[model samples]
Target: MQTTLRRPVALSGIGLHTGRPARVTISPAAAELGIWFHRTDVKAADPYIAARWDGVEQVPLCTRLVNEDGVSVSTVEHLMAALAGCGVHNAMIEVTGPEIPILDGSAAAFAQAILGAGVRRLDTPVRALRVCRPVEVAGPGGALARIEPAEGLSIAFEIDFADAAIGRQRLSLDMGNGAFVRELCDSRTFCRAADIDRMRAAGLALGGTLDNAVVVEGDRVLSPGGLRHSDEPVRHKMLDALGDLALAGAPLLGAYTGRRAGHALTNGLLRALFATPGAVEWVECDAECQRRLPGMGVRLADLAAVA
Candidate 1:
C-alpha cells in the first residue's frame, strides 16, 4: 500500500549553496499525489514544483527543480531520499527559501524525523516502475549511469577521487528491508579539500563547514570527526543515487549502477528510460512484490541502530 506521514514534520538549517537560513515542513498528502515542493517565500506566481525527474534543472553540485513559472527549489536530493526510504508515496514539502536546508549533509536527520512522525498506509496498492530493458546515460568525464531489469531495487556505486583519503571506493546493496536506513542514511556528502577554494570562487558551498560535509585533503580528513563508515564516500554516492532515482515519481524495481555519476547523469538516465519505447512499465505491487520493495516491513525501531 502507499504511505503518507502521520503528521507534519519540520526542519530548519542553513542552505549549502545559498548560505541562507531555510525551513522546510514535510506534510502528508493523499495517495498518488506524488512528492511536491511549494516555495513559501514566493508570493507572486506559482510556487509549486513537482519532485519528478522531468522537473529537474541541470545544475552544478545539487538536484534542483524548476516549475513552468521559473520558480525553483534547490538541493532536494537528501529530503527526497528520506521520503523514498521511509516508504512515503505522497508529500507536500513546504520550503521558505530557494534551497532545502542542508541539515547534516545526509538523509539521517530526515529519515529519523519521518519515522518518528510515523508512516500511515493508504488503501491503494503501491506501484513501481519496472525496467524492461537496459537504459544507460554517459556523462562527461567518463561518468556513467545505467539501469537494468531486477526483481527488487538495488544500487551499486563507484567513486574515484584524486584525494587519497577518498580514492576508488565501491559498494552495492539491495535497498530492501530498511537497508537504506541502516546503511546509507548517515553517510554524509564529501568533497576534496583542494576544491573548496575553487568552489567558493564559483559561488558554491558557501555554507559548507566541517559539521555538514567531510573534507579530504589528499590522505588526510579535515572534518572535525572521522567518517561514520570507512568507505563513507562511496556510501554517500549510493545515497545520492537513491535520491535521484526517487524522482521517477514511483519506486523503481531495477538495479542501478553508477560509475562516478552524480545528479545530472542520474536524471539523464531517467529521461532516457522514459524516452525509449517499451523500456519500462508500471506495475501495481502485489503482496509478494511489496515484500521485495524497499521500506517493506520497516519499523520505527529501525532508527535505533542508525548513526
Candidate 2:
C-alpha cells in the first residue's frame, strides 16, 4: 500500500545558493497525489511546481524545479531523498523562499522528522518504474551514470578527488531495510575551497558558510566539526543520487551505478531512461517485489540520534 505522513512537519533555515531565509513544510496528501512545491509567498498566480523529473531545471549547485508560471524552488534533493527513503508516496511541500533549507547539509534531519511523524498506509497501492533494459549516459570524463534491470533500488557509487582526504572512495548498497538512514543520512555535502570562492564570485554560494557545506582545501577539511564519516564526500554523493532518482515520480526498480557523476549526469540518465522506448515500464508491484523495496520493514528506532 502507499503511505503518507501522519501530519505536516516544518523545517526552517536558509537557502544554500540564495542565502535567504525560508520555511518549508512537508504535509500529508492523498494517495497518487504525487509531490509538489507551492511558493507560499507567491499568492498572485499558480505557484505549484511538480516534483517530477520533467519539471527539473538544471542549475549547477542543486536540484531545482520550476512551474509554468516561472516560480521555482532550489536545493530540493535532501528533502526528496527523505521522502523516498521513508516510503512517503504523497506530499505537498510548501516553501516560503526560493530554496530548501541547507540544514546540517544532509538528509538526516528530514528523515528523522518523517519517522517521528510516522507513516500510515492508504487504501491504494504503489506503482514503480521497472527497468526493462540497460541505459547509460557519460560525461566529459570517464564519468558515467548507468541503470539496469533489478528487483529493488540498489546503488554503487565511486569517486576520486585530488585531495588526500577524499582521494578515492566507493560504496554499494541494496537500499532495502533502512540502509539509507544507517549509512548515508549523516554525510554532508562538500566542495573544494576554490570552488566555493569561484561560486561566490559568480554570484552563487551567497547562503553558504562553513556550517552548511564541507569545504576542502588541499588535504584538510575546513568544516569545524569535520566529517561524520571517513569518506563523507562520496557517501553524500550517493545520497544525492537517491534524491535525484526520487524525481522519477515513482519508485524505481533498478541498479544505479554512478562514477564521478553528479546532478547533471544523473538527470541525463533519467531523461535517457524515459526517452528510450522499451527501456522502462510502469509496473504494479506485487507482494514479493514490495518486500524487497527500500525501508520495507524499517522501524522508527533505526534512525540515529544525532544533534
Candidate 3:
C-alpha cells in the first residue's frame, strides 16, 4: 500500500550550500500526491516545487529543484532519501527558506523523526518504475551511473579519491531488511580538506564545518567525531544515490550502479532512463513485490543502528 506520514514532523538547521537557516515540516498528503516542496517564504506566487527528476536543476555539490516560477529548493537529497527510505510515498514538505536543512549531513535524523511520527498506509497500492533495460549516463571526470533490472532495489557504488584517507572504497547492498536505516543512514557527506578554501572562495560550503562533514587532509581525518563507518565516504555516496534516485517520483525496482558519480551524474542517469524508449515501465506492485521494495519491512527500532 502507498503511505504517508501519520502526523507532521519538523526540523530546523542551516542549508549546506546556501548557509541560510530554515524550518521544514513533512506533513501527510493524499495518496498519489508524491513528494513536493512548498516555499512558505514565497507566498505571493506559486511556491510548489515537484520533487521529481525533471525538476532537478543539475547543479554541482547538491540536488536542487526549481519550479517554473523560478522558486527553488536546494540540498533536498537527504530529506528525500528519508521519506523514500521510510516508505512515505506522499508528503508535502513545507520549508521557510530556499533550501532544506542539512541536518547532521546524513538522513539518520530525518529517518528517526519520520519513524517517530509513524507511517500511515493508504488505500491505494504502490506503483513502482521497473527498469526494463539498462540505461547509462556519463559525466565529467569519468563518472558513470546506470540502472538495470533487479528484483528489488539494489545499489552498488565505487568511489576513488586522491586523498589517502579516502583512497578507494566500494559497496554493494540489497536495500531490503531495513538495510537503509541500519547500514547507510548514518554515513555523512565528506570532502577533502585541501579543497575547502577553494570551494569557499567559489561561494560553496559556507555552512560546512567539521561537525557536519568528514574532512580529509591527505591521510588524516579532521572531523571531530571521526566516521560512523570504516568506508563512510563510499557509503555516503550510495546514500546520495538513493536520495537522487528517489526523485524518480516512485519506488524503483532495479539495481543502481554508480562509479565515482555525484548528484549530476545520478540526475543524468534518470534523465536518460526516462528519455530512452523501452527503458522503463510503471506497474502496480504486487504484495510480494511491495514487500521487497525499500521501506516495506522497515521499523522504528532500525534507527538504533544508524550511528
Candidate 4:
C-alpha cells in the first residue's frame, strides 16, 4: 500500500546555500500524487515543481528542482530522503522561500517529525521501479553512480578525502526494515575546513555553522561533540544517494553503488537509467515485494535508537 502523512508537519530553519530563513510544511496528498513542492511566496509565476528527476537542475552541493515556469526550490535532498525513507508516497511540500531548511544537516529531524505525525496507508497499491540491468553514469573527477538488479533497495558508498579527520570510508547497507532510520538518519553532512572559504567565495554555505554540519580540519574535527558515527561521511553519502534516487518518483528495488558521487552524478545516473531502454521496468509491488522496500516496517520507536 502507498502511504501519506496522517497530518501536516511544519519545520523552520536556514537554508544551507541561500542562508535565508524559510518555513516548510509537509502536507498529505491523495494517492499517486508522489512528491511536489509549492512556493507559497510566488504569486505571479507557477509555483508547483514536481519533485521528479526530470525537473532536477544540476547544481553544486545540493539538488534543485525547477518547474517549467522557472520556479525552483533548492537543497531538497534531506527532506526528500526523509519522505522516501519513511515510506511517504504522496506529499505536497509548501515552502516560503527558494530552499528547504538545512536542519542539523541530516534527515533525523525530518524523519522524527514524519514518524511522530504518523504515516497513513492509502488504498492504492504501491508501484516500484525495478532495475533490470546495469545502468551507470560518470562525472568529472572520476565520480561514479550505478544501479543494478537487487531484491531490495541497497546502497554501497565509498568516499575519500584529503583531510585526515575524514580520509577513506566505505559502507553498504540494505535500506529495508527501517535501517535508514537506525543507521543513516543521524549522520550529518561534512566538509573540510579548507573548502569553507572557497564555498563562501562562491556565495554558498552561507548558513553553515558548526552546529549543523560536521567540519573537519586536518586531523581535528572542528564540529563540537564530533561525529555521530565513525564513518558518518560515508553514511551521509548513502543518505544523500537515497534522497537523490527518490526523485525516481517511485520506490526503487535496486542496488545503488556510489564512488565519490555527489548530487549531480546521482541525478545523471537517474537520467541515464530512464534514457537507457530495457534498463528498468515499472511493476506493482506484491505483498512480499512491498515488505522488502524501505520504510515498510518503520515505527516511531525507531527514533529511540537514533542519535
What TM-score should be assigned to candidate 4?
0.99
Using TM-score as the measure, name the better of candidate 2 and candidate 3: 3
The residue-by-residue lDDT of candidate 3 on 171-218, one tens digit each, is 999987778898899889999988889988988899998888999998
The local lDDT score (0 to 100) that residue 279 gets in candidate 3 is: 94
The C-alpha local distance difference test score for the whole of candidate 4 amounts to 0.94
Task: Please give, for residues 105-176, the per-residue lDDT of candidate 4 as tens digits.
Answer: 999999999999999999999999999999999877888999999999999999999988989999999999
Candidate order by decreasing lDDT: 4, 1, 3, 2
lDDT against the true structure, per candidate, is 0.93, 0.89, 0.91, 0.94
TM-score of 1: 0.99
lDDT of 2 by residue, 1-307 (tens): 8888999999999988888999999999999998889899998888899998988898897899898888888999999998888888899998998899998899988998888888888899889999999999999779999999999999999999998878999999999888888788878899899787789888788888898889898989999978889988989999999999999999999999999999989999999999999999999988888877776666678886542
Worst 10 residues of 4 by lDDT: 298-307
| Ranked candidates, highest TM-score first | 4, 1, 3, 2
TM-score of each: 0.99, 0.97, 0.98, 0.99
Model 4 alpha-carbon drift over 4 Å, by segment: none
What local lDDT score does residue 210 receive in model 3, on the 0 to 100 scale?
Answer: 88
Better model by TM-score: candidate 3 vs candidate 4: 4
Question: What ranges in model 1 sit over 4 Å off?
Answer: none
Candidate 1 C-alpha lDDT tens digits along 165-193:
98899999999999889889989999988
